[model samples]
Target: MTDETWSQLLAGLTNVTWQSLVMIAVGCLLIFLAVSREYEPLLLLPIGAGAILANLPLSPLVGEHGLLSVLYDIGVGNELFPLLIFIGIGALTDFGPLLENPKMVLLGAAGQFGIFLTLILALLLGFSREEAASIGIIGAIDGPTSIYVSGILAPHLLGPITVAAYSYMALVPIIMPPVMRLLTTKQERAIRMPYSQRQISQRTRILFPIVVTIGVGILVPFATPLIGCLMLGNLMRESRVVERLTHAASNELANIVTLFLGLAIGSTMGGEAFLRPATLAILALGLLAFVLDTAAGVLFGKLMNVVSGGKFNPLIGAAGISAFPMAARVVQKEAAREDYSNFVLMHAMGANAAGQVASVVAGGVLLALMAG
Candidate 1:
């Protein structure tokens, strides 16, 4: 072969940087975890694949006008993907639990305290305000909200912040139990919450999303896009007339957008940006935020237990984050381990649903505070 031809053939190998190789390894690890552990495979698998594709030596996927870049511009840049995901989340969400138990909203609100606390801590660690705010949203464990907020405020740190959010989200089943056990005794863990079947009227169900969208939009203007899309899905579901539309939103639409969103986010994880000391700090801070949110929720549950004269199960407090049924399921599993007869799943779902809405509001609050 001619020397010039050989150089052209060797271009990719010669261009490989240590950073790119390391990122490729990281991508493979994410893929392994997703496949073996089944930890959020829907999003993680695509994210890992995108990371690998973007980091390949002399790759064109993330170059100007490339697929990844175009996806990023179309969705992540304009904050379209996350909003669409919220619609799917809303369509899939059953607010009956939360509506039946309105007081669970307080627990959801309490769960978010860690976000602001982490924001303050991130600022203390010398991160700029926008970056710190973005870091703190990881506590919510709502990947879409994390992406939306970080994409707008701290685009530079979006890679780490997105990974931290989704990773902690998948780890909720693992990370929250210790905090629940540490904060509560066996007796507290075994606290029983009987399911109450309140016949929430169809009218109430229809009005709930509408009321929430208007109220949250009025109160937290920045959250309107997130809340609006979410409630639109919920509204479709509750309306009961748009079964086809609802199904499409919750399934087909969500699935496609999730793929696009994950790839766009992963494309941002090039090693030159992701391997910095700040990445480590973001990961550590994200874990801290998760722990703090869980602790705060359980502590608040303990307080409610006191106020209710021990009628409330403190374990339900642990579900007051955006992990949805997973967090609630974890709480129920922990309670069952303490006493097989204990059933807190319904109550925990109430708190979980409330947390879903609360996390979006928290993201908006952060944006409102930091948008200046």
Candidate 2:
């Protein structure tokens, strides 16, 4: 064989490291969970593929001019992809439920308690304030928000934070129930909240996004970018005149950006960056944040129940995290398990919708606090 051919043959093999192999395995595990367990398949599958490609010896898909790097520069680096995703999320979200039960906003605010709690814990464990804040956002269960915040505060930690945020988000149904049951009694679970079908006028619906954009921008200026894009999509959704735009934002735009974002994120999971003591701490802390968020919401719900003379179902508080309809559905399912006749779906939906907004604000607040 020619000298050149022999060199080429040995190049990839010689470059291989145990770190790369472990990362490849981690990537495959993510892929397995995504395909077999159907855990956040949209993001995880692409992330796994990206990780594999990036770790390949002398991969052309990495480095300064590579596609992954370009995607990272264009989207993740500038925090554009996550903001774009938020637009789609806002377009798809239904605020009518929250509008019907304005009081549910309290539960949404309560849901964010874990982010701060986890931030303090992370700080105590020797993480810098910025790093801890980035880690704390995992509690919001809003992957886009986590990405946006972490990308700014501790960009190096993005891979683990994003993974933790989405992974726990996927596990919301599994993780929340135990905490809910442990915090509340069977009677609280069985409490029925009759759905109030309040007539939310078209004007009110149209004004919500606009008012929120202005209000949040003024109050939490750092959050304006995230909230603006989110509310822009929501405004398009509620405008009715922009059905085409809304549909595109919620479907095509979201899907395309999601693909790019996932790949960019996965590319960052190179073994040298991902395998660390801090990474494990991030995962553990992220889980704690999620649990604490759920616990705080449920405890607050219990308080509301007492204030309402036992009329409020504390399970709805468990829906106050940013898992959207899924968290709300889980609450309903749990309530039904206690008593087949109890119905709290609508009420839970209200809290869930409120949580969606609350998470965005929480991300912004973190940014504001961390901003130099």
Candidate 3:
């Protein structure tokens, strides 16, 4: 070979390192989980694809002015995509169950205990306050909120934190049932909470978003963008006059943004950036946060049982940590195992919705606490 061609070959070989190969393997593993295991396919798939692309030998995706970098600046770095996604989430959530039972808000508040507890633990393990706070938010189990908070708090740690949050969220069905069953008595689980389907009027549904946006904005201004966008989506759904916009927001807009956001986030996971002992520690801390959040929520439910003269089932408490319908459904399944006739879906859903809001507020609270 000519000298110039040999030099070019050597340069290319030098760029292909073990770290990149390992990260590419990790990326493929994420894709396998999403595809074969059906664990958050929508997100993990795109994320895995991005990781592979970014780690490719001599790829331009992570270079200066590259597509991933540009997308990151336009969406995640500026904190635009997550806010947009929040709007879609809001439009999709039915707050009627939570509105019908405002008392469930307390359970949601209880769910945030793990965020703070995990924060302290992470700090002790040598992470910076901001990094620890971001890691702790994994307990919230709300992907968008975790992204929003971490985007603002510790942007550097966003990729792993977001992945950990969503991964554990998909695992809620597996993680929560054993904890729920262990904490509650079979008698308690058998106590039936019938689905009380209250017909929430269009007016009420429309007003709910506006009122919550205003209320939450006043209480926690940092949550305004996330809450406002979410509520706007719900308003579109309830108004029933903007089906096009609703469809676009929930389906089209959300899908496009998810793709861009996942790619941008995955680019941040370049081998040199992600192959740290700290990354493993963050993953471990995230799992700890998730388990503690469940424990705290269940314990609070046990407290409510005492206060309510054993009227409330502690299993519903497991729904308090913002994993949404998944955690709620898990609770329902656990309840059914003890007694086939018992169905706590509605009540669990109420706590689940409450958790959704509480997690945003908790993120804001963490931000406020740390920023101060």
TM-scores vs. true structure, each candidate: 0.98, 0.98, 0.97
Per-prediction backbone clash count: 0, 0, 4
Stretches off by above 4 angstroms in model 3 are: none
Name the best candidate (by lDDT): 2
RMSD of each: 1.0, 0.9, 1.3
Residue-level lDDT tens digits of model 2 in 98-179: 9998999999999999999999999999999999999999988899999999999999999999999888888988999999
List model 1 lDDT by residue over 1-372, tens digit each: 999999999999999999999999989988998999888988888889989999999889998998999999999999999999999999999999999999999999999988988999999999998899999999888999999999999888988898888888889989999999999999989877778699999899999999999999999999999999999999999999999999999999999999999899889999899999999999999999999999999999999999999988898998998788899999999999999988888899999999999999999998998765
Ranking by lDDT: 2, 1, 3
Q: What does the lDDT come to for candidate 2?
A: 0.93
* Model 2 bad stretches (over 4 Å): 1-4
**CA lDDT of each prediction against the hidden true structure:** 0.93, 0.93, 0.87
Q: Write the per-residue lDDT of candidate 3 for residues 1-372, one digit (tens) a residue.
A: 999888788875778988899899989999999999999988898888888889988888878888988999999998899888887887688888998888999999998899989999999999988888999988888998888889988998998998888888888888887777777788888876656677778888889888988998998887788778878988898899999999999999998999998888888888888888988998888888888888899999999988998888898888898987788898889888988888898998999999998998888777778778
